[model samples]
Target: MVKFGYTILYVEDVEKSIEFYENAFGFARKFVSPENDYGELNTGGTTLSFASKNLGVQNLEDGFIESTLEDKPFAIELAFVTDDVGDLVQKATSLGAVLVAEPKKKPWGQVVSYVRDLDGFLIEICTPVEM
Candidate 1:
């Protein structure tokens, strides 16, 4: 059987990235490596992990592309489901996140907003879609 365990984002500083998510979204730290080059957060269901770019270079002989302040964010994005999209969006912006879009009701009845994290990663904050 196959199951998604986590999503890893390659960052310049693992600890810094971990701290950013913790403060911006209230996610608790699960573990941070002794070397401070890798860390994980307890994001409820699937884990959110961070690995330093140095670690990525070591793991893959060929280096990987990294998000930068100057570069436009990648086409992909990470989304978090939240009931209060407006409040979360405001808080996220106050914590150094770039506001990409304000909350809006979709035709499907979901309120959604977008923000760019400290590292320029696109994040979608939205109300949960009813099943």
Candidate 2:
């Protein structure tokens, strides 16, 4: 059984990414490197780390090289569980987050809506219905 703790995303600019997470999602900066190459944001117990692409190479050894030919912008969808789905959606919209999908009740009895963050990552905010 593996427990999830954190997810790291490579960003073009760490400062801008941090500001987005803070202003949009209400995540606070928990830790940051002195050079500002990487930092962690805390949202409840989950931690999301943002690392700049240029500084990410520092983690690799000298003999190691990453192939840029296959490198491309990747898309990831993150689902966030919220008690008040409707309120959260409204708040997210007011914070300049783009609403990709309006909140809808799914067949599985969950209310969900999709939104895109500043970096174009899809985020699904959902609330489970009573069985």
Candidate 3:
């Protein structure tokens, strides 16, 4: 059996990125490398991790596009399900997250919104979809 474990974002500053998630989402920090090139957060069952761009470059033979606030967000986004969509959006925005959309209720009865993290990574803040 296999399970999805962690998602690692390539960032300019690993430690700073870790701190941003901690402040915005209330996840506790797990570890940071002495070199400050990598870090992880205790985000429940699946870990959220960050690694420096330098590390990314070393890992991938071909180059990769780096995330920046000035550019449009990439195709993928990290989603966080919450009970209070409005409150979480406000909290994230308060910590410098750029609000992409206001919370809106879907036909399926879920409230959803979007925001971009400090490095321009898109994040979806939403209420869980009920089955």
Per-model tally of clashing residue pairs: 0, 0, 0
- Looking at candidate 1, the ten consecutive residues that score lowest on lDDT are 62-71
Off by over 4 Å in 2: 57-75, 129-131
Error of 1 at 129 (Å): 1.1
In model 2, what lDDT does residue 101 have?
88
Which candidate number has the best TM-score? 3
After superposition, candidate 1 runs with Cα above 4 Å error = none
Greater lDDT among 2 and 3 belongs to 3
lDDT of 2 by residue, 57-102 (tens): 6665453332221332245577878888878878877775678889
Cα error of candidate 1 at position 87, Å: 0.8
CA lDDT of each prediction against the hidden true structure = 0.91, 0.74, 0.94
Instruction: Give one digit per residue, the lDDT tens place, for model 3 in 1-131.
Output: 99988899999889789988999999999999999999999988999999999999999979899999899999999999999999999999998899999999999999999999989999999999999
Q: What is the Å distance of residue 45 in model 1 from its true position?
A: 1.7
Per-residue alpha-carbon lDDT of candidate 1 for residues 18-130, written as tens digits (9 for 90 to 100): 99899989999999999999999999889999988889889999777889767888999999998899998988899889988889999999999999888888999999997
TM-score of each: 0.94, 0.74, 0.95
Better of 1 and 2 by lDDT: 1
